[model samples]
Target: MSDSHELSRRDFIKVTTGIVGGLIGAIIGLPSVFYLIDPALQEGGKDAWVPIGKFEDMQVGTPYPFSFTRVQVNGWERTASSFGGYAVRKSDSPDDLLILNSKCTHLACTVNWSAEAQAYLCPCHDAKFSMEGEVVDGPPPRALDIYEEHRISEDGIIEIFFKAG
Candidate 1:
């Protein structure tokens, strides 16, 4: 008795073709899909030292306002964020430069240098810092956030590592 339930040649070829086709599709398409999503899966918390301006541009005994745009790589996207700070050249020497973040330590409000008051004034919570980033008055836990890593480039540009808190 021949209980034949074996597959025909045509059916066998069709099944093998389908498996092979699927594998080829995966080999080609999978990498494209991974590449598209790779940026999104990358770590976002990274900071770099960036040049803000020339060391000579900062006037002696005055806090010079500086702003720069940098790309922040976050999950799934690259965003351009504007960051602001102050460059203080106490003297003619580039080594005397002090780079300070403009954000107040009290509540992260933007602080402006006040010539009349002779202090960095945070209008949001009335926090004041002296020309040397010391707490002057009102409510602030510590001094203004100062860039710890900074240097004058060979071209005399003031560069500093900006880290967002």
Candidate 2:
């Protein structure tokens, strides 16, 4: 009877050791597999200079909606979506243009240039921004983010770069 009990105890120890080893192997191997597969899955992951429109399409002091797609990659996958904004050419002086992000600094609401108020107004909370994108009143903490714009070729194609951060 003692010998039988000893054999049972040894079997239990072996089974528990095998189970623990399997779990450890799974934990270590899964991450390695993911790392190997990640880059291949992100074949199209790149930052692109999206074209807003022809430079001639925009006029000074007029804001028009611009939309573009941004592709992003994460562990083992690639994701893409369209992002848009109301881009404005504030001045035509010296061929320099000002591009303002449409998202209001306050509460992420859409800001519209109010001809009556003579300011960018957030309808959600009544926040106000000056024509230069400065926060004039309400809960906006800072000015709107300005985008860098460039004109490529004489065809008047306007391109803008957006940072993921």
Candidate 3:
């Protein structure tokens, strides 16, 4: 009877010890797992303000296509992505700058400025946008998307803010 009692006591301790160890591990592990997966479950990307160039570089009445690069952070990796847009300096005032995204609002195609046509033409869909990004003639649902956030620094540099989506 003594030997049997000792065996039962040891078995009960082993079972309780196993359950307690599992509970402790889950308490520490669940939060760590959620923290690692939070970014991946996010809905949208982030926005950043980047300085493209100086205001002096823009030519009045002409839409100049400009290229820029932005860095993206994901999980533990940093990557560089290139972006482009058109900057038009108003013919009347140098302070009046119109910035347009290079991608067409229709199909995300690159729109090229046509000097003769006097419009932004998308080669892929043949969609036309006027100087002010008004849809001229095409199947596009709307005009080109504009980069609304822009400012001139005290030093005359044009800073543009864009979102990565």
Candidate 4:
């Protein structure tokens, strides 16, 4: 009964060995785990000058649709999301352009241009927006969001400064 209540020498050695082994494993493994995942944990640059199309390709008074993919890495995951928008040339001048995000302000549904109706129509709701991106009717609280910063590159490619929030 006394022997059963007391820890044997072999049991003490086994317990101490397990604790030391576990501590050693954690000390070595934790840093290695962090090192392996450090790149994924760090945030990547989301600001970029995204090329839409050739400046000449965008016709005046017409909405030219364009799309691009943005890849974001979080932890061990990599997600690629596609975003689209419309670019309208207001005049022959390279600076005279209107770049609008396709996402409706109300519910984020993609808005399509109605050539016949001459407005952007949201399928989710009956929201209407003018060619100039102003709200014409329906549930939208404000005008369509525009990419305010844009430039025509020296190669004649139109690019908009895209910044992710």
Candidate 5:
């Protein structure tokens, strides 16, 4: 007498069904998982040369205000923040320009150019900065932030090398 094992029909069907079900689940589930998390896996750009305005639009000896929105993505969250600056065309030459960030150094409040006062005024704390971004008065520890790296495109657009913190 000998003992032997045989593959039963029910057992074979069960194994086959399990393998097919696993394959189908993997095929459908992988792409759905990736789609749901693709944004989180992507890297957000933190630096760019942003175009603000045309060089010709900024008049000589005056502060020209310009604003732009920057979007930042971290994981699944997306946020938008507004940034602006004053473009003071010091002279007729494109290279002779002063680009200053509109944020007050004291409290990060937006500053506005007051032509009558000949300075930038911060409503938050009465901080003042000259047209060249020099600290004029108030509680500011330093001058307004300035964009030192900038260029005038051949098409006359003013672009500044911007970096996000």
Candidate 6:
């Protein structure tokens, strides 16, 4: 009877140790496993200069297309994505350039320049914005999104900083 009791006690300790070890392992390893699976869950927004290219190529009063890449991290996985938009050099006056985001403010639909209407039009909701990006009509609560832009040199090379929401 004594030997049997000792064996039972030893088995109980082994089972308890295994349970505690598994729990501790899960607590530490689960997050790492999740991070490895998705990296975007880790953090948001990295500051990077978006290149708009040679300023000489951009005609005054005309919208120029620019493209840039943004990295999204879920947990430990990172995905690279590209975004394209148009910018207009509205004025030759000092720092008079405007970078309009094509995304409509109402429901994030793409806004297109309506040359005939002389406005930015969002077909999804009929939102309209003036050439200057002011909200002229429709469901948009505010003006079209504008990006901060500055010329890298007097020669017309420009760089715009875009913040990812």
lDDT of 2: 0.75
After aligning candidate 5 to the native by TM-score, how far in Å is the CA of 134 from where it should be? 0.9
lDDT of 4 by residue, 1-165 (tens): 245878889888988999999999999999999999887777675889999999888999999999998887666788887888899878877678899998999999999999999999999999999998899999999999999998888998988898864
- RMSD per prediction, one decimal? 5.7, 6.5, 4.8, 5.9, 5.8, 5.3
Across 16-112, the per-residue lDDT of candidate 2 in tens digits comes to 8999999999999999899888767655555567788877877777666677777676766778866666656677762667677878887887788
Expressed as tens digits, the lDDT of each residue in 39-144 for candidate 6 is 4454576766777778778778777767777887655778887666667778776466787778888898888888789788888989999887889998899887
The models' CA-based lDDT, in order, is: 0.83, 0.75, 0.83, 0.90, 0.90, 0.77
Q: Residue 92 lDDT in model 5?
A: 86
TM-score of each: 0.68, 0.63, 0.75, 0.73, 0.72, 0.66
Per-residue accuracy of model 5 over 135-155 as CA lDDT, tens digit each: 888999999899999988899
- Residue-wise C-alpha lDDT for candidate 1, range 45-148, written one tens digit per residue: 56778888887778987899988887876666878877788887777876777788888988888899998998899999899898878899989899887787
Pairs of colliding residues, candidate 3? none
TM-score of 6: 0.66
Candidate order (TM-score): 3, 4, 5, 1, 6, 2
Candidate 3 structure lDDT: 0.83
Badly placed stretches (over 4 Å) of model 1 are: 1-41, 163-165
Clash statistics: count for each candidate: 0, 0, 0, 0, 0, 13
**Ten-residue stretch with the least lDDT total in model 1:** 39-48
For 7-104, candidate 3 gives per-residue lDDT tens digits of: 57777888789899989989989988998888878755578777877788788878878878777777688888777888887775865788988888
> What's the lDDT for candidate 6?
0.77
